[model samples]
Target: MALGTNTGGGGVGAGTEVPALSGAPLLGSLHDLKSDSLGTYLRAQQRHGDVVRVSAGPPGMRADLYCVFSPEGVQQVLASEAANFRKDNAFYQEVRESFGNGLLTSQDEDYLRQRRLVQPLFTRRRVDGYAGAVAAETASVVTAWEEALDGVVDVSDEMTHLALRAVARILFGTDVEATAEVVARCFPVITEYVLRRGYSPANIPRSWPTPGNRRAAAAMDELYGVCDRIIGQRRRAGADASGEDLLTLLAAARSPDDGGFDAAELRDQVLIFLLAGHETTATSLCFALHLLARHPEQQDRAREEITRVLGGRPAQARDLERLPYLSQVVKEAMRLYPAAPVIGRKAVAATRIGGHAVPAGADVILAPWVTHRRPEHWPDPDRFDPERFTPEAEAGRPRYAWFPFGGGPRACIGQHFSMLESVVALAMILRAYSFEAVDTEIPVGAGITLRTEGPARCRIRRLDGPVGPR
Candidate 1:
């Protein structure tokens, strides 16, 4: 809980100095943060309140991170005073260089333009159109599980492949199989490179003859090459998208002010889509299943909901709203294990947060991993109780209390798409099989997205006959 008094004003108020972390003399909190950042942030909040000042690196190259953990403080930084905080920080700049100025890392006028051009493609109605693709890909995965029957399956890796194929299918209608293979082979390398350089106080240029740099460049080359080649072919052939797939829509997407995305711009958008679309949804689905496996009663309850709503039929997009309990289970899983756990921003100017003064130029972090575990809003914060997300309970809490997809203006553009995919896939899987966790815990860390450091294996048994009404 926060050890500070509330200020009822909207504008920045007279604030006191932020409490600093008492870490090692030389490296400060760098070692702990690098090793177990999620745990370190939770400990910092418990010890120093919501707004803690954590300093890292040596004297001259020091980086001061102002971590805002409270729901109110998060709201202030990400929503209320959003203009005062920008994504042009060191991490974001590195991401932009690696990923191109796509929606994820673009800023100012560029962000505004990209948002307008891409927003329509992700509208609730538009994303619903891709449900069949999600269902088709998920069926392929579940059917293959027959080989692992009465045995264990790698849930994490399976979902990663499933989501990759699902998203690839949506993006490239008939070109999915090839693109999915190229992405599965190369994305991990690029993601690792971004995380390695994004955190280091100093960086070696990628153009230098370093092994890591060379690997990252080569991975980027393959990914970029595949996307550009496909897009080039599409443009050359003059094939109109015609609502069949996302790539065509994106290719055909036009901005009222400047028209459609150029060739390089097309590549940037596709890269961001692949990165965000597959990674985060896979994390959510993997953990949701794991958590359900750990709690049999909860798993049974969720399966009941799925059976009642789906009734032995494969899940469709329209079935999302009907499976309320299933949604809660996924929501609870996300709260416990968010894919984008840590987010970074730069202060545009000096501001006050949680009654603490923040410097003009500082690395500010909003941690959903810590905030979601705050005991004040969520009792027994570590438990896997889906009841906490009941509409009544949710309405009673602050809006930012459980923001897995982030909040405000720059929140994830694919928010709707992620939830749709997760729910549809989970409904079908639970209806098909009952899971028992082979590994109760899987160690995970935040990279560009959450990366599972350990195996997430679960035992499965096909449900007898039909799981529910025929």
Candidate 2:
């Protein structure tokens, strides 16, 4: 089925009700839903067509939410009528403590203003320039893995470390490792706390001195301390006008209308960047490597391509276009396991998605996790097939069918930066090492991002000699 039955623009007609997916009258689907929410949503979508209404929260206070699994329904909410959707949903409420009014949590004019300010920092040329830095950081990670090749290495941990280093290099030019350690230490705590609260029926007010709340507060404080110290140092040294690192550019940036970011605003933006910048790409790379490890034929094919294209040199920005198979592998991995598995938006005004009425303040979830696996859109939905992303194949699919980075204007600002980072990092690492999956089946769970339940272990064996012509 493609989305809803009706294609008309106006909201679902009066008396026409989109059937609700069966659940406990009071508890609804709450019992069935677990940390592996992606699996729950996928099963629900298979049973109940495109749009399924489900209940959440505790008994009397249960909240009704809609999950849109159809590409057309997703497109309507994310692109066509996006103005009716706001970012201040339950999820954002949980995250606001950490994100503040930064781009990720802010809505309306504040969001637009911040977007304008940060826009210049991620231009095509600017992101391309970071390829050299990304390549260098990725090489450092591969070299470090040389000693641990004899034991099972946690690709998840390694990717997280590598991604943190890459983003830190891009954000803070000099003290990269030290800055990344601070981010690595605090981000997991803050993100986990926020996600735990987002799903809880009874909420603990942040002001309360509960132990969990206190721990979350301390993490936030440490995060702020680190951001403050670095930004303070940059300000004291005078902003580097020509510098390409995010800190320098943000510190130097002065909007013609609203002026520059104040201390608090700087902290908020940096927190969002630090948390979001590394985490999504890390999750993507982890999944990509895991998938490649499981499919040795595909891994060998990728290695062959890398050898042909790169000779023995580390992957650079110019080499990206030539490595089509590597790009497909990454894209397909994201299709199977999108980092941001579930995206939530609240309706600001009564509207419709797929002709189903959505009341104001109601939360609508668009899950790439569900849509990407919908059997109607993807044949053999569970199969690991990178060929699905080939140019000709992609040309036949719906536009919103594979939006791992999301869609429309509110989509991830760092999409280009992320793609470049993944492609470069994967190429550099794959060329130098061959990974064997230690566990064929790894459990999936949802925290702030899609994650593995335990460490995704892989055995690595280094390729003899250099990978390409340097």
Candidate 3:
């Protein structure tokens, strides 16, 4: 078996043309996609069923997008017949050119080799060891929120900040403070740059002196500069720094056939981790808190479990299992607002999916955002009910029905870490404050990851006096 696939999956298409969404003859669905990609995806699935073919761009460069919304199809594309589809899409190309071909964008032998060398750095035990750091970072955010001039706080921005601090602390260790400013500043610029370019049909040359191009070039230079400086510092520090943190580990990890990640590869890995590690977890935490704010009953239940498990003390790694209700809340949030709302791949060979014939060299999308809301698996799928995730309820559904971290060999490597961070941070936050959502609904847009176009403001009342245990 290949590294990133599974044996079980849905059947191929019966070699028939899937449904094609009606759109402008030349432009196709370009305008709708630019305005709202996720919304468009849901509408497509609702209108045309599970498999639909969409075309975007002008006549010459038209992109035929095969959207797979069924869980069975998702399993086949991401896991079972994974090799038939690959990350050979425009979005990935944009990311690779800007960010370097790190783990997130690498493929085949390169991907396998990168996975083998970096896998040990992200093992569950190693990630669990960072629980204290996650908690401490959560405490810092809780403090900032507690001291907000008004009782209200922006849950989205604060969670993003907290996630960044936590990952940087775990990745860079003592030098986290040194690198935080640049990482914080440059990532957004780069993120916006990648998004604008990734979806644009024009595919402008990066070397062109456009204003957006200049800004992105500057951001990448600064981000790379800071990362290289820190990496160099660790290299000079030698063996003592090797296993102390993720960066150092990247510096030292070697394979039988390879010496280790050279300087450029090391920077690429760090960039991917920082980008994936922070934004993905931040999206989950932000939504979970906002969801709890809206649903007071569920919020209180999660808090009661957190209080029962940790009382006034800090939440550690083991507390994740103890706070099952809190975990459910997080899981539900991820299901509703998956970080990677739409994942894209290119069909490498002719394939059948959901009874539609997908020609070789076509673009394919696996949508967790749409699939998670399938009524068959989730009753009243739009509701914020944590009960949907209970073990018994979860077991009754298809495995690919709720894949937030993706599936198969190419699943998000940092999934366990992301979950741990969400649970621990959520436990600590709920223990500190009670949230009442000030914003009724938040509209989301996906760039590289899920992002809120509006604020996730909440009125948070302090539930505890001091930062320490109750």
Measured by lDDT, the strongest candidate is: 3
Per-model lDDT: 0.85, 0.81, 0.86
To one decimal, what is the Cα RMSD in angstroms of model 3 from the true structure? 4.2
Error of 1 at 390 (Å): 0.8
Better of 2 and 3 by TM-score: 3
Per-residue CA lDDT of model 2 for 297-342, tens digit only, reads 9999998998899877778887778999999999999999898888
Model 2 earns a TM-score of 0.94
TM-score of every candidate relative to the true structure = 0.95, 0.94, 0.95
lDDT, candidate 1, 259-344, per-residue tens:
88889999998888888899999999999999998999999999888888777677888988998999999899899999899988
Model 2 misplacement above 4 A: 1-15, 239-243, 467-470
Instruction: Kindly list the per-residue Cα lDDT of model 3 for residues 1-470, writing each as its tens digit.
Output: 00011112344446776898888887888888888888888888999999997777776666778899999999999999999899987788888988889999999999999999999988988889999888888888888776786899999999988999999999998877877778889999998888887777666689999998999999999999989998888888777664577898889999788669888999999999999999999999999999999999988888788878886688898888888888889999999999999899888777889778887777788889899999888889999999888999889999999999999999989999999999989888888899999998999987899899999999999986445432
lDDT agreement of model 3 with the native: 0.86
lDDT of 2 at 162: 92
Model 3, poorest ten-residue lDDT window? 1-10
Clash pairs, candidate 1, are: none
Better of 1 and 2 by TM-score: 1
Question: What lDDT would candidate 1 get against the real structure?
Answer: 0.85
